[model samples]
Target: MTRPDRICVGAIAGSFGVQGEVRLKSFCADPEAIADYGPLWTEDGTRSFTVKLTRASVSGGVGARLSGVATKEQADALKGVQLFADRDRLPSLPDDEFYHADLIGLTAQDTGGVTLGTVRAVHNHGAGDMLEILGPGTKSALLVPFTLAVVPTVDLAARRIVVDMPEGLE
Candidate 1:
C-alpha cells in the first residue's frame, strides 16, 4: 500500500503559542529536514500540511506553521498528530541505518534462539532507540536497547532480528 512508502518524520506536540504555530517534535536525522520533505500527511493520509519552521521552542523542539492552520485552536486540535513524509523524497540511508517503519513487525529472537516476540514499535525518548517487543502470553511489553551488541543481526530479507539479551532480561 502507499502507506508503506511513507515514513513518520515528526509529530505535533500541541500549539506553540497564542498564534497559529505548532510545537513540533521532529524525528528526522537532520531534525530541520522535517520542513523540507514537502507536504506531510497525517497518519491516515486523509489530511496534509506543508511545514515552515518558525523558531525553536523551550523544550528543544521547533515551532512550526502548518499550512491552513491559522489559529491557536486549530494548532491545538492537531495535538499528537503524526506527520509522515514520502519515502522517496527523503534521503536514503546507509546499509546499517533503518527507518523505524522497516523494523516494525520484524520477528525478534534471543541468542539461544528463543522467540522473544514481534517488534511492535521503536521508541527513542532522547536516549538511544528501544525495541518494544510483544511476546506471547504477555500483558506488558519488553523493552530492549537497539544497540549493536544487544541486537546483533537484523535480517530484513528474512524479516527477523537476533538479540543477545543481557542477564535478567528475558
Candidate 2:
C-alpha cells in the first residue's frame, strides 16, 4: 500500500561512477526539481537522504550524491530504491491535473453510471497516460486511455471517476 502522506519522486538507477555518485531516474514533471524537495525518504520511511545533483547522467538520468552514500559499492547497493518526498512539500496541481497516486483506488464508472471497476494503476509509455481498471471477475485488466475526452470526470472527494469508454473497449 502507498502512503497517503508521501509521493514517489524518483529511483536510484545505479552507481554513476567510481566516486559514489548515483544515477537517479526522476519521475517528476520537472526532473531536476526532484532535489528541490527537502530530504527524500525510502518507501518504508527508514532511510532519508539529501540530494545534490552533480550532472546529467549518460543513462538519461541525473548524477547525484546522496547523503551517507560515499562509496561506489554503497551507491550500487541502493539500485532500484524508490525515493519519496513528503506530499506537502510537492507543488499542488492545476484543476485538470492530478497526481498518479490520487487516481489509484478510485472507483471507475461508465457514462451511464454503470460500475466498471476500480483503478489499479496508471501507466505512461511515451504516448500518454492510461488507466488500468480491474473489475470484480476479470482476469485481464481493462486499459483505458486517460484523455480528457475519455476520462471526463475525476471526483476525488467522491473517490470515483466517470469514463466514456470508447466503442469496442467493452
Tell me the alpha-carbon RMSD of every candidate.
1.9, 1.0
- What would the TM-score be for candidate 1 when compared with the true structure? 0.90
All candidates: TM-score: 0.90, 0.97
| Candidate that scores best on lDDT | 2
lDDT of each: 0.90, 0.93
Query: Candidate 2 — number of clashing residue pairs?
Result: 0
For 1-170, candidate 1 gives per-residue lDDT tens digits of: 33998999989988978889998888887778899997999999999999989886537678899999999999999999999999999998998889999999999999888898999999988799999999988899999999999999999999999999977885
Tens-place lDDT digits, model 2, residues 1-170: 44788999999999987999999999998788989985999999899999999996447799899999999999999999999999999999999999999999999999999999999999999899999999989999999999999999999999999999999998
Off by over 4 Å in 1: none
Deviation (Å) of 97 in candidate 2: 0.4
- Candidate no. 2 TM-score: 0.97
Q: Kindly state the number of residue pairs that clash in model 1.
A: 0
